[model samples]
Target: MDLMFLRATLLFILGVYANSLAVAKFIATSGRHKVKVICFSKTGERAAPFIRQAAKDYFSEASFAYVLWREIDMAFWWNMFGVDSAPSVVFLKDIYSKPITYSGSFNHLQLVKMMDDYKKNDIPQLRLVSSMELGCDARGYSRSGNETVTWYCLILVGRAGHAMTQMRETLRRASDVLMVGDDSDYARNVNLSVAIVASAAMKENRLTFTWLDGEVQQKYCQFHLAPEYHTKSCGPSYEDGVDAPQILIVRYLRNLTDDNAKNDRWKHFRNQYLGDTKVASQLIARYPGPEDVEELIQWISHIVERGDTREFPYFTFETPDLVPEDKQSMGSPVGQSFSRGINNRLKKLHMYISDLPRDPRVGPSLLLAACLLFGTIWLQNNRTKQANNTPGDLASSTSSRGRARARPARTDDVPPSMTDEEPKDAYQWVTTDSDSE
Candidate 1:
């Protein structure tokens, strides 16, 4: 009775442990774009109520999970993400990237601020994967779709610094001002040209706002800026001071008269063959005015007006592609196709393989199976050799060889007799031995 009770207790404990592992894995993988917050605690202890409230408030922006700390997984958590102890929190922006971890306790305000910071950036950085989704790449259509032929991309390029942050905030405010209705205070305060441009841009969804890292994308920044300003604006900072962020606004124009179906087919062909070519002719102009919000807004409004109304020389050039923030998130054609066909089977196989090391029976069972297989193969080979070397088989083979060697030659099997001398012509005969020709 005691033995049975011990076995039941052990099984229940193992079941609970396995369930915790499954829950942890599900939490890690389920949310793709949203921020993932994992709270770790002792088995009986619960996380702060504010953490749960934050998760509820930011449900749309983030995913939250609670993991019970186990001694067995202590090293895994510590080495993989620096979670050294219980009562800790981990914030994951994406599955592939390293997570941000906090070991100490925090209040509700701090927790909320952290969640807000992790959910999304104030102004998103332009990247290869995001360029397509945001419709900022020349190869992609505008946010308003194919009908919108003329669109603008406003980019603020700079390395990470106080100046870059301030300029980014100013740009964000400008974009916000444009996004709002004309009745807003920002619209009323702006000049007539600025108001008109903002209203038109808002209505048509013709403008996209993004930022680029100048230090990382030096070539791209230099390509957009004039040769003289390249040193001033792009690359690493000099001993003098940090480089001020510069604004670049590009006006893209796609041919509207072409057939839509033909264009689509050609676009697909170009994507497959020509790679990341320029699908639109663009006019690029750098902002020369001060970084003040009002002045920046005025300059942008003027540029938009000119791009929309005035005729400019249209040019096509290859632009550098933005680097991907998360390489694992990018999709491959073969990977997508394979996933679509065998996703479920692959998941099951992956789970089974992952569990193999954990399950105590797997190792011994595999070893036993291997031994059985080897023994069976060895016995079969031994039987085959023994059968071939049997006395009756060997004697029969030797007798057959002896008969072949002792057999006499037959006339039927031999060709007609022929001399080993030169051949005779039709009119002459060749002599053999003593005969003359």
Candidate 2:
């Protein structure tokens, strides 16, 4: 009984853990991506294969799910995403945005095109993971490599708005102009200063163009942007009632002088104090100018020409890490998904166990429950043992009483004098005629 109770308690805990894990998984996937494509099908005849193939191509941009259709849940489909039938696809772009539903057959090319159109925005937002890759992070080296000591990052920082959109378009145009080279018609049409900057950027391959969400990354924006512009550029829009988009150019410089003595001294210092630190000293400069393509290009050109020739104040600080856009790219889709699920479950379990010590109610509550369970099991075992011996005890007592009652009692009234006269017995046998016959 005690062993059974222990097995039952373990099963109950496992059941709860499984239920909590499922809930955690649902929540983890909810905010994984801004876009989610779900295919509803009664038999998964065509949509399943199509969605699976599409997921492989656009795995980094959007998430996909396949749901089996049931007639009983027809109203739920319609009311939620207006998906009233099987063989339909619903694209949920955002939490508050309306869903886009389609119910027709589509070829692979058409599906890919549609996904491309919907999955990404006009300008990719700079995230923690992409910052280093794009050479926008101070601690990381340039995308061109360590040999390229100087690099520039052109960023448009602001909240979402028409102004921000227009600025992003201008930034995109500037990037395109640079990519087009000097002989292009667009380059010739541009001003001389813009052309010079574009030419220098193309020749060096040291410039990267990206955008930042000022509201989301307020600390980074505030740190880089001038104090006067913080009200108009960074933080929530409601605070200043202004969402003016601003462009900032960052220049990064690294020193690669080979001094063995200096290197050895620094190495010794790191070993003694820092202990395996990867932080390096680098100089950074921010552009303080209006948001104009011509001026921006000219500033970049000047920085490229004379940035290394001059000296600037060098500083080091920890920067915020960017969120990765392609977390599922490391392995096969199925393996990645399975590993992610296991990791999430283990992380949740760890968190739950870690919190138990901190929660004041958990310790005592668990102890009380354990004591109650043990007591119940002990009582059950005791009752079962007694019940098994009860019938044997009753049988033994009854047999002893029967034996006692079966014994005959001797009385004092009976005389034993006739036994002593044995001589008369020899002649007494003739008196009994029936006995003699």
Which 10 residues in a row give candidate 2 its minimum summed lDDT? 271-280
Q: What local distance difference test score does each model get?
A: 0.70, 0.65
What does candidate 2 score on TM?
0.51
RMSD of 1: 23.6
Q: How would you encode candidate 2's per-residue C-alpha lDDT over 1-437 as one tens digit per residue?
A: 99999997787666556644643464357443345777777885555566677887766556777777767566556877887787777776444345678886566787777676653434456765456677787655677775577777778888766678678777766676666666667668766544565466655658888888787678888877778878788877885388887776777765343212243544533432232333234444566677776666777677766654666665555654433435445455456546544653565355446544755676798999999999999999999988887897889989999999998887678787866667644755436567667
Best by lDDT: 1
Question: What is residue 304's positional error in candidate 1, in angstroms?
Answer: 1.6
Tens digits of per-residue lDDT, candidate 1, 18-60, equal: 7558756765565443567878888746657887788778764
Error of 2 at 216 (Å): 1.5
- Candidate 2 total steric clashes: 5
Residue 89 accuracy (lDDT) in model 2: 74
lDDT score at residue 421, model 2, on the 0-100 scale: 67
